[model samples]
Target: MAGILVVNERYFPDDELEPAQVGATSFSRSALRCLWNAGLSAGVILYKRAEELTEPQIDLTHRSGFRCATLRFNFDMGADTVSRAIAEAAARLCAAYGFSSRAMLYYQTDALLVFHPQELACCVTHHGPFVHDFVETFSARETAQAFGDAAKALHLFKHQELGVNSVRSNGRMFVLQHSQLQREYLISRGVDERRIRAIRPPIAPPTVSEPLRDERLRSFVEGAELLVFTAVARLDYFKNVELLVSGCVQARKQGVPLRILVVGDSAEDDVARQALRAHVPEELSAEFMAVGKLTKSQLYALFSLARSNGIFVCPSRYETLGITPLEAALSGVCTLMTDSEKVEARRFFPDAHRFLPSGDGLADAIGLAYASPSGVEQLGKELREAIATEISEENFERDTLSAWSYFSQSARQLDS
Candidate 1:
């Protein structure tokens, strides 16, 4: 029996663990479940800040400043006893298991994955001639390099030279990209085309047999005459929740009766929330509801009500592939998303559904969506049909099985 060790920095839900039980699990859990269902003997390993190394774990791997900086960011320590303890624990585990320990996987939540490519590569290389696979759900340019470096290191360790197998690429995006650009990027990076798999992150399928629209939410949507913009993302720089609020305010000033709903927690930390409170006219503020995080059921119910009433807007500064828009599309709601040049929202939605350039442009797009409710309705119907055709259980099974086959082949190669 081969043991597959999955090193993740966060907790996963049970459904995302084994047996592949879908429907409402955390992101990490869903990924784990996906891996387990593929028939690999996998177990989870959580890496805490207290368990990181003080000095470099692998020789000539990471620079001293880089190592310290990584530790500081990940563990909140400049130099401490806890850091040493964590380092020892990781070293022991690596030494005991050796490079033959099935497959070593790493998944992280913070920006560390983006910054420390060389260190990660060194760690994997030090561990050895074992098969190494790197998986990241969210990563920026810096962290992506770390992932690339780890792949590169694995190739060098196994082949004894750096040529083609030195690195493998798997870039996760919220929106699918044109196949040509994706392929070109992979090839340019010297990644094995076979090794680079574009696995779109999965959302826990909604399970309510019937929609759960409460009277308050329904009434709220129904009463809103012009436009209703909504966003459900953490209060982070990239989310650009403020853009929606500001756009709504601008739309109202322009004589548009636009109402906005900014959902999810972290609103308290949002400077924009404060700015909106100060800038939005009292009448307009009433129209804009900043209801914090709601339960999944509550969110779905609200979505259903919104579909029956208004348009959904996702004004993210950067979304690898925005899922909310897809959810809105499925719920029979029209969406107006930002047109980040790199993103491929058009692949998923009609051109009319996207607005590029600025927040003012988003306001303009909202008006467009509102101007032709009948056309929006037609778009909604089309969206639902597309989702139904593309995201069925059969489709999930086919894609998932294909992914498993690829992983299985890699695992066998490692065993050999």
Candidate 2:
């Protein structure tokens, strides 16, 4: 019998599977580990959509450590619309893999948009900020319409063999939400409440770093009294990275010393980066530094350096579950984030600093901290202890198994 099939865009590259990869990659690895620990057969399908790639191929390395199968397929498709992209990719996958009915289909965020498989128990892990993205970027009416379209497009999955047309109406696969607010948002958007389950991901303890070795990082941290701020995220609008730059500009205008290091996949010539550079005044340009991707060791060094008089900011406008801020808190850095209701920042972290997603608001928050960092520093220690206690590895293991158990039970019923 086929075991669980994990489908995602990027299958944690073999060399980068360390705990430092603590976003979607970490969750993917954790899910696989959970399934493996449960003694169930499992495999992974790393699907990469391409326009010229000829055929699907199996990756030998993906199945190296785990005694499971792994297939690397390329789908010829355009990035026109997210839904269409997903549907086309799903079609290619179904054609290539002849997916069995008994196998549990677990889809990451990208595959969940429009690929609703018929029969064959499937589950979706919500990782992005769909509703929040719409509301923040568009209007409420647009958000509602977008949610309605998604619901209508992906909700119904037929169980033809079982003579059940209302599988979705009942509980078609489990919809694992990263947060209670996210699950509630899905329910509000007409998804069956029975099919939705909110399972906060298990966060591993932050990896400890050796003493700071990089001289450049050391200089950046100790060079100035500038309140060092570090942000890690994609250079996307919803990530609200521009706000961090805007905040730095605002702080500089107020004669406050501040320096920010943005670490992510931001290229020098990227549109967003270019726009930000042009917008910032020449005088304030030195206040911000955009470092593209860095190794895990480098990241740990930065986090360690920021432990004193520095803060990690996650100014994202929408988040299913903000992992970076939690990770920052774990690393003993004073973490500041947006006060997004959907993210429920306070619910998970009562002590971490928060601000509204605006240039002025972010600047004020940072300014206050810069003036009196004692409270922010104390908050970091509190947050570290809180995360270690609340998200203990033992608790995460138990929760992950419980989540799988619930889905497995639902899958069994479908086979019945």
TM-score of each: 0.63, 0.76
Candidate 2 residue runs with Cα over 4 Å from true position: 1-5, 9-11, 17-22, 50-64, 67-102, 110-119, 131-172, 211-214, 266-271, 342-346, 373-376
Tens-digit lDDT track for model 2 on 259-323? 76677653353555566567678876666566554555566667776777677787776566777
lDDT of 1 by residue, 127-151 (tens): 1111122223234452234334556
Which ten contiguous residues of candidate 2 have the minimum total lDDT? 156-165
Best of the candidates, lDDT:
2
Error of 2 at 140 (Å): 11
After best superposition, candidate 2 residue 241: deviation in angstroms? Answer: 1.6
Candidate 1, after superposition: displacement of residue 289 in Å? 1.4
What are the Cα lDDT values of the candidates? 0.47, 0.59
Position 376, candidate 1: lDDT = 59
- Tell me, by TM-score, which candidate is best: 2
lDDT against true structure, model 2? 0.59
Superposition error at 64 for model 2 (Å): 5.8
